[model samples]
Target: GEYEVLGEIGRGAMGVVYRARPVGTNLVVALKRVEASGLEGTEAVRRFREEVENASGLRHPHIVPIYHVGEQDGRPFYTMALIGGGSLEQKLGQYQADPRAAVTLLAKVARAVHYAHQRRLLHRDLKPGNILLDEAGEPQVADFGLATKLDPGGAAAGGPMAGSLPWMAPEAVRRDATLTTAVDVWALGVILYELLTGRRPFGGKDRSEMRTGILQAELIPPRVVNPRVSRDLDAICRRCLESDPDKRYESASALALDLERWLRDEPVRARNTGRLERLVKWTRRRPATASGLTFLALLLVAGIVAAVTMANEQDARLRQEVCRGNEFAARHVASTVLAQLQHFGEAVEGTAASTKLTEACDGGDWPAVEELLKARLLDTPPGPGAPPFATAFVLDPEGIIRAECPQRHRVVGGDFRDRDYFRGARARADRPEGERVHLSRVFTSKNDGLDKLAVSVPFRLKSGGPVWVLGATVPTDATLGVGGLHDKARKAFSVLLAPRESDGEEYVILVHPGYESREPSVPFPAGRLRPTETGFAADDDYADPVAARHPDYRGRWLAGFAPVPGTDLVVLVQQPYDEAVAPYRAFFRKFLEWLVAAAVVGALLVAGLWLSRSGHGARV
Candidate 1:
């Protein structure tokens, strides 16, 4: 029997939703029906089934539940729970004049959308219209019929569906349909903008115009539209709506965390606008006076000088610091590689002992030797514990793998003799030098497919020949501890590891924690290293002469380089310049302020004395 279709509840480009009750149960639900005539028959059926299957799998409280799917009179239909309240679009219109209520409501919707994203589903059609409010005013995200699973392989070919264009991310509009969680982030930014400013960030009369605006137009800052919104909030919104997907928050969780942090009065994760914004904010808050103007001018001049000086000092310090950090990380990673090699060596030695016995009993069993080698090669290492390094790969002296801890099929017989680490170790071994570990200059790995630090230690065979050079490869990302180095000191400070090239040229290889925000100065060569700057040079007694002439720079930063134990690399640590120099900046500001006050007072006294003298003369 054909299922009965009830009154229409909502309609859109893809389908129409209706109020319906299933047979025998009398259970009321909202049924969505897609017109088969409007789309390709098999493709439409597949899409409908996929949507139903995907939507049914989601079990979050914020997401609307999909109940059942079937055909009624040759048309596809899916039923979902009938959410009782109006859509968020209606709520927005109802509360158009109230910014606080709108922001609060949109934040709730963001949370729901974020929940869906956590499950790897993107509500590609995330607009106020798609979000429905329940009786208790909780947002329930509906109409996932247009949602797409974030499968990198199954990305759609065309531009995002037209209905969702207003809330679509710029990349989505550009039809770069990788459709990451960043799309959701962009939509949330639009919602936030609309909520605060009482209007869509980019609006036009038609879809084409809207798409054009979204793809090309810059977002008007929330503060520009609504003066009451704080600069911090504006910054957050701008970050979310950044045209470049890479610049946007990586995920909805990151966005939600930032928003929650902002609400809780915690420091937000966003870019700082630096002294320009600070100066503007200061000027806006102050009264205009002759002394005040002079003070402001002096302050600006001093700040520019300080920033330039800091940049120079930072350039040198950053290289040293990155070198030190990478060197530290390299040593740890090298140790891990060394341990794996030592284990492999033991395995090889054991196999050799067994093979000798087998050979003595059976006239030199070559097949048995081959089988033993294969078995030892195929043996997997134990689970890597929480080591300081990210990854460990091993290579023998000929740059061939005897065994690698993180076993990969590609590196087993691969030749690495041309690699710097291999060449350096072999050269050292040719000198009949004692088995020593040589840390290769930090360079991006050409064979391992990542930026890596290579540590090579030569192993001598029983015949006094360099049999194998054990090379350990540690990926730079892993060594730097991606996103795991956040600390109070890191927040106000920076650390870097710089390595010197063969000709004594230093350059930055690694910067830990918050390198993106501070934009630390490190003089890495554009393509190749320059002479006179061999990686980072450590001077425990290093002092900036320019800073020495200016007391403000005294004790602003303490820097020292220590050789990464067991490696030629150096680790440099720089204390927080802001914290170290806060006292000085504050003192200088106060001193200048008092000096201006004193000068003003002295001028007034002189003027009074002259006036009194003139009055005495007139009386005479």
Candidate 2:
């Protein structure tokens, strides 16, 4: 042997495969020799060579890479990266009952198939035997012998379509059917079914019977066979196995992404078909039969209406409980925030009134003023684990920072004349003397680049002149203050919103877990939370299509809001609406399922009784 054949891997319709060590190289490769009896002709060899050239162009981690093509003793052969773990066929037993494992494996393979399709090539024969696993147990598609190079219109060129009958698409079973990329999708669905349920979806004793089954058989959904298979996975499998090629996924990529979505626990397109949509599709397929079942369905619908009324009542109760719970949480959080803000205010006010600070400022002893500020605000107080204030600084009459605690030398001479805090403190004379401490709008601190709320208090070395502002900064993200109040509210998350002074936006989100930086408020989605005379209330409307269709809609949320008692800030708590009404929704779905089943049985009984009476009358 020119190459040392370590062992025979397998024999297939295209060639005999061997695990071989190439001559004069340390590399081990899987070599296939084109020794199939009828494929020895020159044209056949050329086509094989062309197919290998095309397969070689595919470079994907999940697709076997062809290394070399050669011929020896008038037999063509090609070598590819040797996958040592064996074919997926041999490993099917391991993932028999594990749908996630099967989906994880198939998603990669589906993506590789899609990659081939993008380059106008079709892997017409995608079966478990053709999917090889490497040492790491990653699937790599192999054996593209029946692969077709599609034309520009995406149709396979003329040839006798060859595929394993068991894995062939229904359209492929018919001689007149046009071949397309959907055949590959159908094969993947079969492999996925086998992986999930340990048996193929369509099977029979002979090829003829199997073809019939493939064309006409009602598929026992993957979930029905393996209770462990989820509805999403079952739907995905069914979508791929649609007998009508047009009904199948548009491309292998679509199938792959749906499977990946399922793996990520996100919404999948396959499972988005609502029950009514499924019913409509079924009725459209059999109009006459649907007409016969209409009366029975109406009776079922009447029952469904009654059940929905009861469910709505139960849901209303749940919604009330959830809303009240959210309101309580919001109030508690608001109170906590108010107390913290008041404490911060008192600290700023007391520092502003200090006689020692006034003496230092009057004498132009800036270092003494900085020390006093640091002692009062920068040093950790007895109760807090860390200092509550991020920074404390004194500004001159011109709003220039004269001195700062934990001083940044660069910020010492920096002017903040345009800042809201500076402007608000300078105008404090317009308000009553007791309201001199002003809470500025949330602003990003220049010193630390974190969102900070400034509590600014104005004081004078002499009465009513040269008012210098004393300001303390508190971080919005700190656990000891504003953002942490919702820590105990497990069912809901909190947002702190500050009333905006500018135009075009309602509020500026001071703190939100969802946003990376500050953002202007968008309209509160309709039917989610609305203002009532007493307080906030959630509407019972379930068909808010805007929220349902918007990609960014986190989910439907029932919200409660409370204003911080002395400030314009609002603490809003939102809980997922679905979770709050989950019990009622689940019970309703089960009820509809049973009602539909019972309706079918009842309809059949009524028809049988009517027929028996008619036959007796005819005999008389």
The number of the candidate with the highest TM-score is 2
lDDT per residue (tens digit) for residues 488-571 in model 1? 544322234446443345555444433332232244432332112434343333332223233533454444333433444444
Model 2 error, position 400 (Å): 1.3
Model 2 ranges with Cα > 4 A deviation:
1-294, 309-321, 381-387, 429-434, 478-484, 487-490, 500-506, 512-553, 603-620
Q: State each model's CA lDDT, in order.
A: 0.59, 0.78
Q: What is the C-alpha lDDT profile of model 2 across 1-620, one tens digit per residue?
A: 56888899888655788989978978889888876565556666766776687798999999999988888877888888998898999889899767788899999999999999999998888898889999999999987777888888877853464778899988777753468888899999999999999999999999889989998999999899999888888899999999888898989999999999999999799877477888999989756556657878788889989998998788878877876877778888888777777777788888888999999988889899999988888785413343457788888899899888878886788998877788899889446666898888766667765566688988888876877898987654423444455543355667676643332234555555544332222333323335667555643333222233234436577667777887767777767787677767888999889998999897787667767867898999
Lowest lDDT 10-residue stretch of candidate 1:
381-390
Best by lDDT: 2
Worst 10 residues of 2 by lDDT: 517-526
